[model samples]
Target: MHRTQYLNSVNDFIDWFASNLGHASLFAHSYIDRRSNPAAPRTLAFTTLFDACKQYHWKHNGAFGSPAGACLQTNDAALSALRQALQSAINTVNDSKTLTASSAVMSWGGVRAGNVRWLTANSKGLAQTIASVCAALDSDNLSHPVLTSCQPLRFNAGMTKVYSLLVNDFIIYDSRVAAALGWIVVKYCQARKLPAVPRDLAFPWAPAKEAANARLPKNRDPGLGNYHFPRLISGELHAVWNLKAGWILAEVLARASHNPFRNSSTVPALRQLEAALFMVGYDLPLNVSPSGVNSEPESYAEGDWTECYTAARGKLFHYRVEEGGIRLLDGRFYPVAVINRMLIILVELFGTDPFPLANSATKVRVTPSIPGIGYAYFQATDERGNPPSASALAAVLHELGVLNYTPDNRAPWALDFGDYVQRGRIDLEALLKLESERHDDVGELIA
Candidate 1:
């Protein structure tokens, strides 16, 4: 394959593998309500890992696409095999056992944000082995000192399968590895009687710094082997750029709103916009602590909680219902069932029928895919099904039937607020007034 094409394919496969791996673990853990307006934990995890991995890979080599390919192909066998391991781990983590959130470890290390030494020590060696295999795949850096480590070994499968298998393996193993590490840390804590730290359902790796990205660490000591896989136990950003654009869209649509009931295009358009947010890219929160570090937090608001929000700020997500399917901007895709999942979420958040839109009344076909970078589109169509119209959406909702619009059922998503704030009700008008008065960044943008 041409170098550029080869790199693109590799990256694409990586993206797919990352999202799948993260999602598999997350979906197994909890059924999230997207409409609650909370972020997708799995999706955030995927983007975080991808960026970190990309950054790490790029560090040894200058650029990712071409320069990195040379490094990857040299030791293709190791890389390929490792990828397969990661994929297997991802699948196994979800299907093997029942993993509860309370018992989960969100990050393998301590409470500190940059504690990747534990992760790197375990996986960095693997990257080196893979890099050795990939050294011959590219023309540019074949002469580099790193290439000297490259020992050509014959491979069995086609390049694509080999690559896919390797990616899958690494991801699966990555989970196992991290969990193992977490166990070790926990043990150490228990040995000394350290208090247990809480982890999110899906354990997340830390984000990459702007100056240097993170890379997989080499296996430091085989003694850590006991930590790899427990026979089956399983688990598992900022940006205002899109906010400005979305506000612009919302304003444009608001202008078209005619009757007090609804506008011709605005409601669906906003729904589409909401769907697109899932597709947009964002950073994720990660928890990590190095061995020998002080793991306890001296203050309440400083550590992991702070990290979580920082990651939230880095995510710029977008979703839109276009031609019937939900599209995401971050190159990951989901089925229309995912769309309904999202709509159900929003219905709960803003109250059912907050807009003129309704669920589709007929059987539907859903396929979600991202054909290019920076976005994913989901296409939903009726199978002789229902006429594809705004009303059809409502029809489907009616057929499926229950809408989650009650208080007792909505507590998992509730945030603390005074009577003035109104817990369950999302007062958009009041919010707008607050924004207008504050005249902050969001207000300025929306205004």
Candidate 2:
């Protein structure tokens, strides 16, 4: 959180959209490819990237947008459904004296029952917090008066969704959105060639469902100490940060009045940018080097890799088998899955074979923790299972007799899947290219 008093950083943020639209495009393209290449953000026109990212978000984001392709014609349906459902639930419940816990939970299913129970258990606190939010909505000074509950409430992760429904222009400030937004701010500071990132732009990150550096999209660059984001806990701090983000983004949109999204396209809402950030946020740097931070990822031919779950109909994602890893259609080569030994992984669509790092012999990892930076396991998944498998990486190994699993096991994991990863000639070449091309940034002393 160290920083200099760089007051112009906020204006520079707005200016990023106004003058740096092309760079924004590049950032957007590279942002989509972050799962494979986190350290480097690509360059493209902002207008083009804006559209591409929306489609990407629609395609992959677990219905944060849609389950593929923006396609213009079908883009508004899901968002409309989400907004309408929540708006209706909020507007009709007791004519809006306060957002009841019942209506809030009904609007956003992600709210934990325990949090809802807590709100229900204390009516006074919920009413007070709702009033505080309403007051902020009415105020001109977004940052002066802090937004916190009278009670020790820490359900901002869930309640924000409810509040987003009740309040206009608020977004679901989850871990992904927070991480992506922070990364964007860091990039703006870097592009402006600022001496250091000021505290005003330093947004904190919250760990997702898993512990250990889920490596859920962060700055992998070491020298940029002033820019490194701190982990955020969910409570008053989270609410304050969420409000700040909303305010900052609102300013950016308002200031950048004629920025493509406003005039010709049906895409002026704040949610479009939110959806874009959610997609790009899913990635982190695989390798970073001094050759230049924004190296271009290898280009995959149209038919290089088959789309997984094609039988799932409109569920479309195509990938390429290349030197670095299995590159998704959108240029995402994430470390999603593994054979279970290599630091627990993150295979998104297909199973890949890239588990080169060894686990600590002294440590015993709990199954399904998704522990480390690792490889992918590819398998065909025609049907999404109960609790759903990330990729049917195990099914491939099971058929080839490389590993085994049971119906009782939900994830593609086994207790004794062995420590070492074996690779054939092609796989080894790609793994070698992964090392050569990725140019990983580890072991360097921080500046």
* lDDT by residue (tens digit), candidate 1, 1-447: 233333343343223322332232321211121212434322222232212222211011111122222222322323333344444444444311111110011111111111111122223243343334334322322233433334433221112122223221111122222332233333333444534432211122221111121122111111221221122111110011112222322443344323121332332434332222212211111223444332321112111111111111122333222233323343333344534443433444444222322222332223332111001101232232232232322222221111111112212121112211333442223322222221110000000
lDDT of 1 at 214: 15
Local distance difference test, each candidate? 0.24, 0.42
What C-alpha root-mean-square deviation, in Å, does candidate 1 show against the real structure? 26.5
lDDT of 2 at 256: 72
Model 1 residue 366 CA deviation in Å: 30
Q: Provide the RMSD of all predictions against the true structure, rounded to 1 decimal.
A: 26.5, 15.7
